[model samples]
Structure formats: structure tokens, C-alpha cells
Target: MHRITALAAATITLAFGLGTGAATATATATDDAARVAPAAFSCSPGNFCMYSDWNGGGTRCQWPDERKANTADNCSFIQRGENVRSVWNATGHRVQYYTGTNYNSRVGSTPSGQGGNLQGSYQIRSFKPQ
Candidate 1:
């Protein structure tokens, strides 16, 4: 009777461990509403352009009239999954400038010209530091 009971207990214990082994595994994070804009966007930051709109200094990356075109000449940008501390790896882009409109019209024209340049101060949006 004792031998039979010991063997039965050991079998039950092994079965329990095998049955719930996956429970100890960690759960992964899932964001259903997340945006898939990684590796960068189509917004360009034209090289060697004027930025008189801010009444600021020269050598600005804002370009003449570039609003949104993938201009990776002088600078580059990167997107991240979430925001976090630790600047070990790049989490976001150090945008020389941003554009909400297409720069097709600004072609072959100066930035200070009529509708050829970007006007007003743009609100800089913050992203997670990857």
C-alpha cells in the first residue's frame, strides 16, 4: 500500500507540472491601436536652404519650402514603438525640420517667395526616446 501511494503521488506531481508549465511564461505587450510607421516616413528635410520665417540664424535644416518629403540628405529620422528613458539607442529623430504639406510647389523657387516658403512657428511634437 505504501509503495502504491508514493508512486501515485509522484505521478500526479509530474502531471501537474507538465499541464501548467506554460503559465510561468511571461506575457507579451500588444497595442491594437498602434501605428506602423517604423524605419522612417516620407517627410523630407531639404538640404542647404533658407529659414527666415523664425527670424533666426542661418544654417537651418528647415530648407526653403519643404514641408513633408523624405529628405535624408543632411539629417535622418527614426521611429520607435514606445517612449522610454535611456538614450543608448535612438528612439526618435532629431528633425532638422518638419512638413505638413508637399514641397512640390517650392521647386525652383526661393523660400522667402510667395507661397514658396514655410511660414509660422511649427509645434514640435515629442516622441519616445528609444
Candidate 2:
């Protein structure tokens, strides 16, 4: 009787341990989902826009036509000499971005209907269809 009781208790402990582990994994997954940051911009169709802040916040500059050189003079954020930290490519073609004026320094490209945050050095100075 003593041995049987011990076995029952051990089995219950093991079952509870496994259940706790499963609960912990589910909690971790929920936390990860909550930590993901969602895109924060509303880009219009047929245009390309840049944001002064990451994930598309802050001032924005948009153009219907591809810009070989982003003057950014008319843009509130770029007018202050701040580079683009994020971009939304709403056009139907791939967009090549540059870190230098007149598309001199190629940085990266964004596919149609996509957007993302940029590296610190990849501040977009110009963009055109690829």
C-alpha cells in the first residue's frame, strides 16, 4: 500500500509538471505576439511615401511619380534635414532606394505593396522604379 501511494503521488507530480510546462509555452507565445509592432502608416495607392520615424510615424513625404532625387524640401521632416527611417511602397513596381541624392548611393529596394523600417545608414535620399 505504501509503494502504491508513492507511485500515485509521483505520477500526479509528473503530470502537473508537464501541464505547467505547456502553460508556460502558451504564455510565451502570447507574449511574443503582443510584442510585435504593427505598421503605423496609411499609404495611398499609386504612390511612394517615406516616414521620418520608424514603422511609419512622424512627418511623411509622398510622390505619385518616382523621384530620382528626393529634394524633400517640401516635406516637413526632410525639410528639416531628417532622412527617411521607413518607407511604404504603394506602387505596382519595385522601388530602388538610394542613400545619396540623384540616386548615387544604392541602399535597398522595396517590392510593390510592401514597406519596412530602414537601417540607420540607409536613410533614403531618393527612390525610383527598379
Best by lDDT: 2
Residue-level lDDT for 60 in candidate 2:
76
- What are the clashing pairs of model 2? none
Which of the numbered candidates is closest to the native, going by highest TM-score? 2
Model 1 RMSD vs true structure: 18.9
Across 1-130, the per-residue lDDT of candidate 2 in tens digits comes to 9999999999999898787985654454234212221237557777787888888888878887866586464677766778788887777778998877788888899877667788744467778889
Query: Over the stretch 1-130, how does candidate 1's per-residue lDDT look in tens digits?
Result: 9999999999998898678744422111012111121111111222222332223222233333223354333322212211111111111222233332223222232211111233333321221111
TM-score for each predicted model, relative to the true structure: 0.21, 0.65
Looking at model 2, residue 128 earns an lDDT score of: 87
Clashes of each: 9, 0
Candidate lDDT values, in order:
0.28, 0.72
